[model samples]
Target chain A: MKGRLLPLYVVALYAFLHLPLLILCAFSFNSSRFTVWEGFSLVWYRMMWNDGALAEATWNSLLIAAVSTVLSTIVGTLCAYGLWKKNSKLLSGSLYLSLVTPEIITGIALLATFQWAFRYLQIQLGMHTVILAHVAFSIAYVVLVVMARLRTADPALEEAALDLGATEWQAFRLVTLPMLKPGIAAAALLAFTVSFDDYVITSLVAGVDSETLPMMLYAMARRGANPVVSAISTVIFVGLGMLIVASERLQKA
Target chain B: MKRLRALFLLPAWAFTLLLFLGPMLIIVAYSFQSKGIYGGVVEPWTLENYTRLFDPLYGVILLRSFVMAGAATAGCIVLAFPLALYIARSGTRKSLLLNLVMLPFWTSFLVRTYAWMFLLRDTGLLNSALLALGLIAEPLPLLYNDWAVIVGLIYGYLPFAVLPLYSNLERLDKSLFEAAADLGAKPWEAILHVILPLTAPGMRAAGVLVFIPCLGAYLTPDLLGGGKSMMIGNLVQNQFTSARDWPFGSALSLALMAIVMLLLWALLRRDGEELL
Candidate 1:
């Protein structure tokens, strides 16, 4: 029973999990507009290449993600630093507070404040605001990941630098930063990916003109079921798959 | 020197307060206010928002979301436990396969969700396959309903449940199982007396990790519900976009958070950690 049931269970679980995604991949290549498998074609790929809205949205998404990643990384690294040096109760509690809060709560709270409190603050509710929201949430996640790395990190290396007459800034730049590179890289990748994928937070914060790919995709999805969504899904899967593979290799190295 | 440390932390602290806590404080305050005629929070305290939310129409939807979220969490635990055990048994190969499992998580959640409609809709992938197999005369009603939501929740959260259980199971003491067997305990007893107790914390962690998020999920239901009903997340969404009632939305959100806290307290009463 053990031997017979084991692979049966694993295969069954993963099949049930991924069967939908596989359909999405297969249907993306289907030539006919209908979802049923038609003669295969690369027309969707060609269309994606020429689509101006998608082209512009792609650039906007990349810019938002990059900006959020860098900003979140710096703030996160310092927050991780303060939390590390003291491990004080207040810092630790607040850190865990944001980490555990539901994304919806955070999203709505920020939305109400942005559209209400800061409504007259004169900041345009566009790319700038979306990036700010992304960075806020992304910083929490990045801090958590980097803090875990910092926990097992030997501080002696930094101390050694200080012992050799390196200033605090010099010690961090040369010694701590190098050792923290893998952790920082992982944090950046995570921050970027999440910022890229986010819909709820961005939707509430993004201006009418500053549409991320996800918001656009969400509109297409909710308005009606379209096979074009499948094509978009396939492209994202391939793109993110490459990123994941690349990151995993980098992390291992 | 301490002030210097504070300087490094200033940016995050300020943003989290302004963006995170400040808005949350607004939500908390709004929850107690009256809804304006024009669909915003009125500048006065009233229990109208909270009372309005509990009306039967909204209550039914809340009940539906709870039932669905509970079913999803239970299903995920059942599916993930054995899978985690098998992966734990695989030793070195476990990490690589596990990495494969987490690969989709790096992709956009929107795409993964839409992927479900591709497989679950009538005349979609699974139905077509079933018809081809000559097993069913018709396609299954798999999409835009409870089952679709369940599938999405499990698919989205399964990796979370699996990774925790695998680590907990891997850390189990083999000697205890050996001793149980030596005492003539059957396989079932070995699992119950030795394995289950040892790894119960994994279940607790897995359950909380999946349940709390599932409770607030909007997209899965909105995309898959097909107007079957509204959920807590959907209610909040509608409050902003359609209802235009921010005060009521805030009230509903606060109640949802309270429900989450109550559930956490209830779950912690059965601390799986102490099971060992």
Candidate 2:
């Protein structure tokens, strides 16, 4: 990064990463009769709004993401807390396995388990199953991110709180929990975003009825690269960017 | 008190044990069981699924998956190490760059991937741009082949590699380079002798993170690899969906898990040694 090349290096990397996405956003509003851009217009965005099926899928995705984010955060915090106390090499390795294990393996394995177990429980797949799958991955991620944060937090602060007559839960709520807020917020947003965007695992585990945004987008893209899909992607991008900004603002507040 | 300390980890242990390890064990067992004609596990057990898993056609696929994953991992490391070094050198400004790297994620994975498909195809951006520049008389064949799949894979997994290496390089004992220089070692030699060895664990971590997932990657390869080239992931998917060979799919799933576990073990062992 010396002389003339430094800015060029940055430009090249940025272009490599974002050029396609910029093109997609540009075409989303394109007034053209085709996929390629003719001129900017909001017709496709209007079309996206009017599509009832797309609207329903959007609702499903939001609900799934919210429920999954909350569930995963709770479970992940508990799981990370549990692991933090133990601190055994053996347990650490096992925790890492959950993160490293491929989604397909977990998806199919859980499908088989659900098929066998839930038949008696009478649970046919739908939003619940999709949430469950999303939670599964989210919890692993939550555990990982929160654990990293927890490691940097001082154990003595909790001990001092306890020395001042705080109970374990009191120490946790008064000190540890407040300190870990940013990590939790980060983990929640990240988990929600990932779950909202997932396609393959959701496709495998979900029943016939649960068509998340990604599932719809995948079908649309597969059949043909429909122009409306660009509009949908634009909506997702702007919404996620807002959510991310809101999360950061929350952390600062 | 020690036992009480153990109690804290119960949730993590239980989560990993039940969801992670338990499902893995189930995959192993399910793979061995006979496929019931009605699309579930049969009463009888057999190695029929595992045997078919090793059939020449599938074997080629398994091999190709290794090659693709290896290529992707290499691609990630090459770009990641240099990029991470530069960013870490840039210090506080690095976070901005890191966030920008993650901006692709504001869009859906499907959308990001589809954008690549649109750009790399015959009449896509690179070809059109190149043709406009008269850099080439004909459009470059850039999409729907091994190279495109590799590009897509590297694109998806780059941040994973970069993050680990950045921190790893950033935390390096700066004095080590000074010591190497004092010992008359050239800058390259100093890096090779000190920095590379120190960052070996991070490199291994990045490799495992990138390679293992790349091996089982379903979307990038399927979308970009085209029907012509596929990995074990697509095969497993087919067995479950199109092929309707649940038993075979189960076996392949178990095989995939095994490969992941093995790599994880190797990585952790190396990481442990490196740390010590």
Write down the RMSD of all candidates, one decimal each.
Answer: 2.5, 3.2
For each candidate in turn, the interface RMSD (Å) is 1.9, 2.9
Candidate 1: docking tier: medium
- The candidate that achieves the highest lDDT relative to the unseen native structure: 1
Error of 1 at A49 (Å): 1.9
lDDT of 2 by residue, B33-91 (tens): 88777777776889988889779989999999999999999999987776776777786
lDDT of 1 by residue, B1-276 (tens): 356468778988887888777887989998888778987777789888888877998998888888888888899888888888888878789878788678876777888888887677776777888888898998888887788888888888788788778888887877887899899998677877788878878898888878888888888888877667467898888887788888888988888888776666565577645422
Q: CAPRI verdict on model 2?
A: medium
Per-residue lDDT for A144-170 in model 2, tens only?
778878888888988899799988877
Each model's lDDT comes to 0.80, 0.79
Rate residue A115 of model 1 by lDDT: 76
What is residue A144's positional error in candidate 1, in angstroms?
1.9
